[model samples]
Target: MTNDLRARRLALLKEHFASEVAQEFDRTIATFADSPRYEIMPTGQVHDGEDQVIAYHRAQRTAFPDQRHENVRFHVADDDSIIAEFDLLGTNKGEFAGGAPTGKAFRVPTIAVFFFDGERLVNERVYLDSASMLRQIGRMDLLG
Candidate 1:
């Protein structure tokens, strides 16, 4: 039987993904605790608190307006974290950082570690390769 903590964590994770897929980002943000945080390892970018997290998502959408994820699997990592393996697929249909839209696509594997402080998600750290993703999106120069 799942402990109450585990159950709440699992449910939060589910709702998080479901809300994202449904394009209901506001609902997705509701799943987070009062102070939410997100860390992108490759770029050393950190979004802390609700406002920063929202800005982070906006920048992400500006780079890949149609970004979506497919969960490959998930595992409980101790009592406070859940590791989710997924594929992050998206098209470069919108400007990314300083680069213009390429109209290319990228499908890359990613692992996101979701951290919880007893049922409320406090942080999410995602690991992925920027070079490969850039190459997949028709940016061979970024690979150089």
Candidate 2:
């Protein structure tokens, strides 16, 4: 059952991230069997491997320690690709890039696609609407 396997993999990833299971992150991501890559669409930044992923998360947590991501939808492709939609909620209490501690709360929607090799995630592309997020944090003046 391909669908079942995909669901299991998705569950593993969700649990690993939500619970901050470092070992599981390593084990699951290691299934990629090669250097993994992530493309962040909003910023056009590409990150490679587990170390980069960990670093990215560390930076995010440093800036928004209380951030929480809630999954809103999921789509599984025939080729074992997964598209997940989520809502991120958090208060910006620390410096993020140039935001300067807005201490404001924001809810931002994001979508990410994960490509899997067997059970391991090999690649990811994430889409985030940063313009709206910047507006919510009171940094962008275009929304008034």
> What do the candidate models score in CA lDDT, each in turn?
0.84, 0.72
Per-residue alpha-carbon lDDT of candidate 2 for residues 32-62, written as tens digits (9 for 90 to 100): 5477677989888888887886677667766
Candidate with best TM-score: 1
Q: What are the per-residue Cα lDDT tens digits for candidate 1 across 1-144? A: 257778778889989987776667788788887787899999899999878888888777878878889865889876678999999989998878678989999999999999887788888999998888988898777655
Number of clashes recorded per candidate: 0, 0
Which candidate's lDDT is highest? Answer: 1
Each candidate's TM vs. the true structure? Answer: 0.90, 0.80
Candidate 1 runs further than 4 Å off: none
RMSD of 2: 3.3
